[model samples]
Target chain A: MINNFHSLLTIMMTDPTNLLSLGWVDSFIIIVYFIFVLGIGYYLLRFTKTGEDFFMAGRKMTAWIAGLSFVAANLGSLELMGWAASAYQYGILATHWYWIGAIPAMLFLGIIMMPFYYISKTHSVPGYLKLRFGEGSSMLSAVSFGFMTVFMSGINMYSMAIVMKVVLGWDIHFSIWVSSITVMVYVVLGGLLSAIFNEVLQFMLIWLGALIIPIIGLIETGGWDGMVERISQNFPAGDYTHLWSTMGSFQDNPMGIHWTGIVFGLGLIISFAYWTTDFLVVQRVLSAKDLRSAKMAPIIGAGFKMMVPFIVILPGLLGLAVILPPLVGENQVSAMNPHSYNEVLPLMLARYAGPGLLGLGVTALIAGFMSGMAGNVSAFATVWTYDIYKPTHLKLSKKEESDAYYVKIGRWCTVLGVFVSIGTAYLVQQFASIMDYVQALFSFFVAPLFGTVILGMLWKRATAAGGFWGLFAGIGSSIGMWAWVKIYPGALKYIALSEHAKDMAENMYRALWSWLICVIVTVVVSYLTRPKADSELVGLVRGCTDIPSEGDLPLIKRPIFWASIVFAIFIVLNIIFW
Target chain B: MIENKGISIWFFIGSLLLIYGVAITIANVYEMISPSMEKQIVLRELNFGVWWGILLVIVGLIYFINFRPWKKGNNNKN
Candidate 1:
């Protein structure tokens, strides 16, 4: 065993840079965290007796727990590292992701979309399609979602392993195996219950552990103004500090996109598609105890999510202003230039945190990655069991399976999903470019799926044929656009409407076009095809469904009230940062 | 307080924070008492661990008390 471990370490230590040295105190904290999460899984195991319990946390999470989990599910290590890197590379413009790219979409999900999802009583987003459109669209979504989740989980795993290798000199294979096994054990044991509980915990850990970096950093840099001045001194050619002032043209900002792309592409299409349609996050809210909690979950999530930039972006800005040697981009990283933009967060942690605090910081990252893996695997298991396996096999077999049987399948599927993710991690390691493409593929379905789901919920005239064809067309066009750029690089100017447009701009515009195509196709096709009867659309469509009242609680107690307050803050934050 | 039966999630979060806080404070105190003759990180003299630990402990204690695992009924008021 010792010899094998040594060989594995030798083989997997690809990154020569080892930036962190954890003391015994730090190791203890990490060990304690691992043990505590596993304990929570075991403690919740008894409660996860039925399929509902396993898949939906017995539908009993409060708004606070579910809300935090909703945000935490998306707050993976990759997001933190990537956004911080973006901050270093693109300046305060990167904050657009957390603020404009996320807040409005999250509020929309809470105020507009939650009622449809909660009232429909669907197990998954694809399940909602099964109700609204038919089996064809549902199966397409389920199969695509299954592939996306597993691949995305693998990408998260690979990213975590790389971070560990770079920062702590841990073996990639060892990190992969240990994290996969831990996530598998907990999720298989307790399913979504374990995932949600751990997500909330991860959320707290991320805040506490990472909040120190910006705190110490701001103090060292003499506050926001000092940091901005230092950044300007370091690089005066670019407008990295201001948000909107530099967004008039693609050349004005480092991100190489106009305000229209930021507002329409990212803000409207990608954000709404993700926040409203992604089952990984929606599952958390679906587990809420009631409709009010369901609505409030995303509202509360938006409130906290708006604050994430402080820990993520501020640290990168601090690193740029205060660190002696500027960090290089990923392409520029080499033996001579050892520091990459992605290393900013870990580097900040190493610089600012003492031994014990360092351990906590590392734990926070581990928790983030693990929660992300759990979120993906659990969602995959749900879709696979409910939308894929049951529909394709069980219904055909005509077997009356027990709820416990389905729960057992969910457990086994979670294991299978983790194993598949491990395989994908190895696959990603072999071809680095596949990781980028796989991540892009995850988004290819989002905008189109959002179009179909939103249309099905709001428009009773949308036919089943229109829904499936529209989704198919949108997904096809998105992939076609991506291929157009890849095959003909010059086409990007046409697609993004500027020669200065970059990959980020390409993504936003792609989502926008795909969503528009989906809507147009659905509208055109619905006019040609036979529409579903209004009677048939009873509980699913807006005009036919009688929306449930969330109670005449005092004005302050309503979700819309809180949502309004959060939206006001969102607007205020944009202006302040602008 | 998922399902209002198991331990409150707040209590669980608080307990973890309190333990980490206490451990960090102890380590901070130990390091301060016997300064190591090595290069230190930024703001080591500021005793960030001590103060951050204390803050975490105080907040953790508040959550722990309000939604104590020992008191089942005082949870999930939302």
Candidate 2:
């Protein structure tokens, strides 16, 4: 057993440099994957004839397709690389973002929010906001979302380029251009359907590509207990293994976030904003054929989401346990720099996967990057065409244009969006860490958007003026807090309760404060402003809307039944990990 | 037209194998081309990509032939 373990360790610790080089088979596999993606887009182009087809997949998607796309769209290189890096840096505590931060919000979206969104038959989140709170709130959200989507697309582009350059010595510009052009082609041709199809395909690839590393590592370590023991031996950070143990206070955790900050700031504010309101994710559910499928989509996504941390996070722990120590030992820490912890996933892929598998793994990373970019650009195209162009450009014309005309505009927006994303990718070069920058962006836009959305949906009294100002207040507060943290540098420690928690606290606490400010401002302004009549708000607000009755399905087939089972499993996992 | 009953199970299975095959081929080829002292011990032991790729291709082809959507029927919507 001892001899076998040592041999396994020796095999796992093969020189990292050799792992970076790709062979012919790997290149062929990658080429094939790209061809498959492009082919699917071309094939789907015939189906996307009208603007509705372009933006919403003709509202014909089933529960599984929409559900897979919903989860896959979010499971980009950003999530994989960013969370893996976070897992390396913050340990199992990073799992909070996946479980508490995502699952609950996703479940809430399916159960509580899908009814309003589906019943309204709006084209986008901004369109729904327009129906609920009028043009003022809608325009604010549409413009903000437009910019956010393009920026996020660029981040994915930049991340993909960096991985390609680091792993295969590919030029960063070459990588970015190849991916951008490929994503632009399919998205422009087939629109949201193409993106959704590719997202589903990429979802499968990501799982298959990523599954091997953890399986190999666990076998070597003997299992979960063995991995925990080996990790402790190598790193001696007991807190890293336990999820909730280190989360007692800001000072106690490697993440430097207290339970209050984790539970409220991220779990409540950031997660809810991203899961329930983000157009990129919500648009998938909105594409479902019926209300039941729309609601079931997110419930299915939540179940899949619960299993994701094991795939993305475990590799980071494996890197910390097996890969980093040898590099650190050799005084070659520069090779595996702690600051560029995002390299952890790529590094593990190189070490574990041989040629053919290696190609698939790399293709998986590329697919993730493309799927993320495609999702963002498609969502951007929908908002830009419907909200921005239709209102500003089409409104000026005396005659109403055909659906084909709008489809043309959507295609143009896809082209424009991709170019803008390429430009934004260059901007991402300035950021030290992709995840931190992404989280900060989310706090700035999503947190505030959530504030208005929540108020508009739940409180019929939320006037257009109140929704607009509340959203504005939330965004302003988030930016102000970000700037304050930058200038003072020491302020986060004071606000967050521990000196160690300062960096992460800046984002979490900013989200919390921004949400508070938005809610407060909205409530105050709502009272001052005259709200729309109940007639105008029919089917828009919770009280005014009729709940779609669930047909008498069997317990096993019911969404609520599956959601409860997921929640129970989530509780058990947390307790065990705690 | 493909029914909204979701993607066929056989098609999904075929795709998964093809992906696995391609991935394995890439790994094996990389090992063969980039031979080193450390790699020789591991790479020489496992040259599974080509055979695996061939096997997966055959299985995938069989599935595709049996479950091709075009053969089932077509819808005028396209």
The deviation in Å at residue A468 for candidate 1 is 0.4
What is the RMSD, in Å, between candidate 1 and the native fold over all Cα?
A: 2.6
* Model 1 fnat value: 0.71
> Which residue ranges in model 1 land beyond 4 Å of their true spot?
A1-16, A334-337, B72-78
Per-model TM against the reference:
0.96, 0.89
Model 1 CAPRI rating: medium
Off by over 4 Å in 2: A1-19, A324-332, A335-340, A428-442, A493-499, B1-16, B19-66, B70-78
Best candidate per lDDT, number?
1
The sequence of per-residue lDDT tens digits that candidate 2 reaches over residues A1-578 is 43443243234333455336655556666777777778777877887898888999888887888898999999876678778878887789889988999999999999888888999999999999988887888998899899878877787788777766666666678788888999999999889988898888788778867776786667666788888787788777446788887777766876667888888888999899999999999999999988888989999998899999878999888877776443222133564453256678777776666656676677778878888888899999999999888888756875677899999989999999999888878877875476466656655988888888888888999998899899898899888878777788777765555557756666777777888899999999999999899888877789998876667777787888888988899999999999
lDDT of candidate model 2 versus the reference: 0.78
Candidates' chain A TM-scores: 0.96, 0.93
Interface RMSD of each: 1.6, 4.9
Candidate 1, residues A255-371, lDDT tens digits: the string is: 889999999999999999999999999999999998889999999999999999998899889988987578897889777767888899989988989868988998888988998
